[model samples]
Target: MKKIVRLISAVICFFQLNVQAEEPKEYTFAINSAVTPLLHAAFINETIKTVERSVAPAKLKVLYVELPELERLIENHQTDFFISTAATIRRYQDLGARDVLTASSPFSKNPNRSEGSLFIVKEGRSDINSISDLKDKRAAAGRPTAFGMYLAAMGEIAADGYDPKTFFKSTQFYGLNRDQIIKDVLDGKADVGILRACYLEDAVNRKVVTTDQLKFINLKNDPEHICLHSTRLYPNWSFGSNPSVPPAVLSAVAAGLIAQKPVGIGLYWSVASDFTAIDNLLKSLQLGSYQRFSKEWFWQRIIEYRFWVLGTLAAFALLLIHSFIVSRTVNIRTQELKESLKRESQSFHEAQEAHRRLMKMQRAAVVGQISSLIAHELNQPLAGIKLYARTLQRAKDSGTLTEDKLGTALAEIRTDADLAAAIVERVRSYAKGARSERVSSEVSELVNKAVREFKRQSGERVEVKLTQAQPVHVIVNPLEFELVIINLLRNAAQALQELGVSNPKVDLTIRRSDNSAMITIEDNGHIEKETIAKLSEPTNSTKADGLGLGLQIVRSIIENHGGKISFSQATSGGLRVEIRLPVQEETK
Candidate 1:
């Protein structure tokens, strides 16, 4: 009986072992069709090995399909695990999927994320160095669903000031693999090609292509971790578990992926990276879940939140009313300001014309005063000439006119006649008011001439001294400047003679200061302080015989030549007149 029981227990144990072996736990993994068939197989095999090791003694069944099918599977809770690009991963995450791990590429700058797309053209293709250069050029890329290659490439192109949809002459999507796009670029079928970063390196390592055959477009230097990339880095392919997955299994799978060594060429699995940038890219492109929540979707949401919508509408209406009121007010003020400016401009022009006429009248008054002085100066010479003529006639009639006497009388008559002519000529030139051209002239020369003319005209016994420290040259209208000096000197001599000083003296000094020439004329004569103050004013004179126009005209002429004239009490006595004129740069 005991032997019979042992046989039955052995038979039951064999059956139990067979049943357990035949019915191992099963987990479904879905992979998108972004990779080639062979690559897809390899990826699946690798994932199976990882999951088998993690959940010991359990089996994993992977279903390879396109992105749309995988998305459906995730939504339907039919997929326990999913491996795909960031965009699809974000869709899965939105459906309550937990991130398991993210794949790390050998060319990634960070192990936690994948590098961006790479733009390339054949060697000697100089015309395709930049995205703008790609305009009207044939280009190739992976499928539009590829985030790391096609979408990323489009993002980079748009960032470089080009519309991806319209910039290129033609854009061809070479299925879901990068190899065909690269081949198209190399074979001259396409002018430019874009692929995920490190694809070229992989091809080169595999001996399928040479680096010398192609040029990288928009290649950026990244010292932190070397790679060829153009767009911003994003989280790499993600492996996530569906919400129905058990917590224990998910924990075990995460631990297993973290423990696995790099498969090849520094490719490994790591803790899932942040998907924020990937979500932003999808939103920007209006893809995946973001596609449904577009501008129209936003309006729907606003309708759902009716209170917020009403508040926004009310605020917008108020803003429009305020803007209208402010614009009207601004327009009214602008018109008023324009009218005011027009009136001000008209007043300014009228004032300018009036000032010009007043200057002309003042000049005429000055000419009148100078004419009087010239007539007075010519009177003596005329009288002398007449007396000499009478003497010569008398000598001839008395028969006492010797040849020597006749010669002496004739010479005296000629001398007086020449003096009268010179006075008349001087007056004529002054009255003409010729606009003399400005030229560089020595200030000392002008002062000496004025002093000599003053003595000759007034016949006053005033001691005049000129002190010049150095030669000073000024830019001036010589004729007008000389008149200015003459007027000042004549006034000084006249004042000295009127004061009746025992030893009347005048001193003229010239010196250079910086870029200016200074002339000072001082006299030793009694003059009141009030007289000095009013010296430059028109028709204001201290002397009973003075017209006071001399000093005023002198001031005007000096000012017109960009010079200044001032009067001060002399250190010794009388008045001191100081004139400052701009010196010529060449002379300095």
Candidate 2:
């Protein structure tokens, strides 16, 4: 029986080795159906025939898959090759998939910038003008995360300094039915529709929908581009291979795609070199490959351990007190037994106050150290409340307090209060050692809010101007980010006030520097270059009552956001503080 089993095992091993050594006779290709309707059965069959003929002696099998299943298939290396839209090409690359050739659809002459989005509103609708106008409006798109239909339009909203996640009041993520979205928009089923750029032109050309029926929001002014796009253009569909595919197979496949003529109504493949446009788009929206950076994972983990850290700190403090008590009791008991009962009792009670103040001093010092940092949290918001109250009083006295004005002021006040509370909660979270949360926030908006509050406080004492800016996004905790800006603005305002220039001006500028955002805050105020150099050493504050920690804290916060900050004396005798942060740039 043992000899028979051994023979069977040996036979199985031999077959396995032979299978491993032999070249594959067949390969499987997957098509993401959610990406395009072009990858139907006929197209897949045509592609398979061409690939198989090019790599002769090896057959190709094709399968259509939805986005979710497609991702899984590629992740598990269940498919040797795939076809996907440009939005997902980078995602697949992260999943160990490599693009061999780009599918240049017969629809567009420009394959690299072939795909984009159209924000469709009713022709008769007068309210919708731009992508931001779609906020709180009923909308139809293929899928919430679909590149052509949804994310592309949302990118416009984000570029305009608004949160895109909550743009639509109601979304009909009607999957794969691009035409249905348009139909729903026309029928008033949706207030707006998100559709692929060329699909509308195709519909109009085919007489399926008249050009007068739809209106595009935030229309691009690129006359050279064929499509009347509402968003920036991205690359077309792609041809990719799983990382597991042999290098030889990948090369053969690319050669086949590159060699193939326009087959099946001018369908063909073209090589694409620069996908920087698509990468910038994805980064701006914090989607696909940039999703990991968008998460506040660092702060989130700290929050989860917040209680444990706080508890540990408390336990350690208690342990210190317990050890001291034990030591004191032992010392006293060992020595005082030599004295009378009354004297011993008196000594123990007298020493009970931790030998009169040592315990009090140590415990108080530990607690004050912890609470000191938390004290700064409410300063900005409280100051805003006071400013608002003053503004309301002045507005009322001058008979300029309109209902809308009052409501706006009150709302701002409420928002500040909420932010103050959130800061408190965040401090608690940090104490528990929980990581803080960060999101892709519009830099202009954050800086603008800070400027507004600072201006309110300064009240014509210093002239503030935002002279230049670009649409840039950064992942940060919004409140903390705002506070950082507010602190800097306040510091600049203080310097300008002290300088006493007839036109004391604090000029703000923001722009893109490669993959980072460069923010410059300049004031016509003098500061010693030596002082600026030593600003990080914790002894740099010039103000007598200053804690001397403001700039250091600002630098630390900026560093935490994956950026650097520095101060320099400007040539004009003013202070120039520049902050650089990793950014997600927006396409103009």
Q: What are the Cα lDDT values of the candidates?
A: 0.73, 0.74
Which whole-number lDDT from 0 to 100 does residue 7 have in model 1? 52
Error of 2 at 209 (Å): 2.6
Please identify model 2 stretches exceeding 4 Å from their true place. 1-21, 34-44, 54-56, 205-208, 221-224, 296-588
Considering summed lDDT, which 10 consecutive residues are worst modelled in model 2?
A: 365-374
Error of 2 at 121 (Å): 0.6
Runs in model 1 with CA error above 4 Å?
1-25, 33-46, 53-58, 66-69, 295-588
Best by lDDT: 2
Q: What's the true lDDT of residue 433 in model 2? A: 51
* Deviation of model 2 at 278, angstroms: 1.3
Residue pairs clashing, model 1? none
Residue-pair clashes per candidate, as listed? 0, 10
RMSD of each: 17.5, 28.5
